[model samples]
Target: MFGKKSRYYGLATVRNTDRQGRIVQAVKLRRLPAAGGVETVVTDGSQLDVMSEHQYRDGARFWHIADANSELEAGELVETTGRVINVPKR
Candidate 1:
């Protein structure tokens, strides 16, 4: 099982723990497609290592999913759930 794991796999936040140790926060994923198109990210930390302002922004924008793939010709706030990595266990 260990050998089958993705190299980019690592701990990811699945909730927003509060100061009191309560899940008051939202979840977060670990790995992301690297800038060079390689799906890579550090896999030794409990949290996703530092991400630049732009890098973080791009991640947010890419979290889009949709139905049967199709070409776009206009603009709209469509709901989507495209390729999404499962939030790793704590």
Candidate 2:
């Protein structure tokens, strides 16, 4: 289960039988919203949390930016210097 502030917090949990005949419990896939936002370059040594703090005022909300940009692996957003990423509006 996720915390109240987690992106997955309010998602529905589903139970499914896996190919191995095991029951698996998992949260449903979270759909990304269509957001209009500003683009920012990933500066050297910059992290998503830092960017989130500047944009959303809550570092834990970095997923908001990641979700807006359809990033499955958030770390990839900052893996390269000068890479541009979308920062969702508050």
Q: Candidate 1: lDDT of 83?
A: 27
Best by TM-score: 2
Q: Which stretches of candidate 1 lie over 4 Å from their true place?
A: 1-13, 20-22, 37-90
lDDT per residue (tens digit) for residues 27-49 in model 1: 25333442222222324331222
Q: What is the C-alpha lDDT of each candidate?
A: 0.29, 0.86
Best by lDDT: 2
TM-score of 1: 0.20
Stretches off by above 4 angstroms in model 2 are 3-5, 16-22
| Model 2: lDDT to the true structure | 0.86
**lDDT (tens digit, per residue) of candidate 2 on 15-78:** 9999999999999877666889998998999898998999888998888888878567989999
Give the TM-score of each candidate.
Answer: 0.20, 0.76
Question: What's the CA error at residue 26 for candidate 1, in Å?
Answer: 1.7
